[model samples]
Target: MEIRNPIPPFSLETALEKVQLAEDAWNSQDPIRVSLAYTIDTEWRNRSEFINGRENVVKFLSSKWQRELNYKLKKELWAFTGNRIAVRFEYEFHDIQGQWFRAYGNENWEFDDNGLMRRRFACINDLAIKEQERHIV
Candidate 1:
């Protein structure tokens, strides 16, 4: 696995960098690449589903992109303390049938010493919108 840089105990700049790195990684929609940012035994609660370990994380992300076609995401750093960070994000995607939707969410992340995420909890809700309502493509 490629070791991620900017290991935690983050300064304002590093925290912002972390958030942007996460946004960039997710935007790539590469499940394995994204999963490597987390610990091998990482734990996650994404909405109602509970995911444990890096392998499951890959599976979850793969399923997500399958349903959320052409996904585009933006993430903002909400706060950071110690090795933990909170983020607010919005993502635009269409279903396989091409019904547009925007999802707004918050994620709380805890990272290990190596900067690999150890835990992540997210709460998200989606709103249906017309194509014209979409601000991000």
Candidate 2:
């Protein structure tokens, strides 16, 4: 059996669209919707650990929300190619104890012809401090 590409076309516009969709999904705080953006067998290297599959994606996201309070994220498209995109983003959230922190990260995403993410590698660094320490909103 042959698989068909679900995406309309590969262009800079489509790349931007995918980024916007991801941003909206994250903003909604819906783990399932976010997971759907990736392939069923997606591979991920988030910070240190390696995770695969949609089920693991959902679980990881759920755990993330459980630990990160008042989570809000913003992602920007940095660059793109035929089936790859680079994104830079920052997120601010508080811990279980209400100790606020900001995390900055960059991600390289590879998509299949159907535009579903096949691989994602992200590197993030977090700085935890008091709320008063924040300068950027």
Candidate 3:
């Protein structure tokens, strides 16, 4: 079944702006700032687990940083239609044992009328290897 987006075509530019704001928030690594992009009751499915609420989002992100040291992420806009957007990104981080990992993923987002994300779904695959194995510059 084809899912119809509630937002009109003209509003896609604003959606793109929101996507940029979220990207900036993630790059900052401040969970508080990133959490603002989502609604207080936002829902997310990251891989297999389900996450709900802004506070839980922040907690999950904080825990992620504790494990993924030196975490850096870069997101690229792939496609968008009104309040929905698709992004492709790569993130690099090292664990406590100093083993580095580069994860590649794509996320699909849905936002409310106020440009706050109401739902998000992400699919990620990781290659856990030494730092020297990376080829992308």
Candidate 4:
């Protein structure tokens, strides 16, 4: 049982802590590092793609970071109760050609008793933006 700490049945403070931790991990852009926060059999729905298991999480993140260069992410806790949390987030990134984009979205996460996220569903939209228009720098 690998516990990630701040185990569920979250309070406002712990939920906020969890959100911040996720934001920091994502900003690092290290797929393997980020995948550790989820369960071995975690499931996800990001945008239109459906992914299952930690292996796929790593693969998905690797592909994402490769195309989304210099990515920076910010996540805010929206609501929480028991083993679930909801968040609204925004992230900024650029492509290989230096075209910048900002993505805005919401995510619902369900955690296992051990504190690893067992499920995640995200709704995100990306908009083309000039570098100067970036909110996350």
* Clashes per model (N, Cα, C within 3 A): 0, 0, 0, 0
Better candidate by TM-score, 1 or 4: 4
User: lDDT ranking from best to worst?
Assistant: 4, 1, 2, 3
Model 1, 1-137: lDDT tens digits are 64576788988998999999999999999999899999999999999999999999999999999999999999999999989999999999999888999999999999988899999999999999998999777
Clashing pairs in 2: none
lDDT per residue, candidate 4, 1-137, as tens digits? 69997999999999999999999999999999999999999999999999999999999999999999999999999999999999999999999999999999999999999899999999999999999999987
- On a 0 to 100 scale, what is the lDDT of residue 110 in model 4? 99
Q: Candidate 3, residues 59-121: lDDT per residue as tens digits?
A: 988888889887878787788876678889888888999999999999999877666778999
For all predictions, the C-alpha RMSD in Å is 1.2, 2.9, 5.4, 0.5
Candidate 2 segments whose C-alpha is farther than 4 A from its true place:
1-9, 132-137
Off by over 4 Å in 3: 1-16, 134-137
**Residue pairs that clash (backbone atoms under 3 angstroms), model 1:** none
Best by lDDT: 4
The candidate that achieves the highest TM-score relative to the unseen native structure? 4
Stretches of candidate 1 off by over 4 Å are none
Candidate number that wins on TM-score, 2 or 4? 4
Residue pairs with backbone atoms closer than 3 Å in model 4 (clashes): none
Query: Could you tell me the lDDT of residue 54 within candidate 1?
Result: 98
- Candidate 2 residue lDDT tens string, 10-59: 57787778788888788777889889888889999999989999899999
Error of 2 at 124 (Å): 0.3
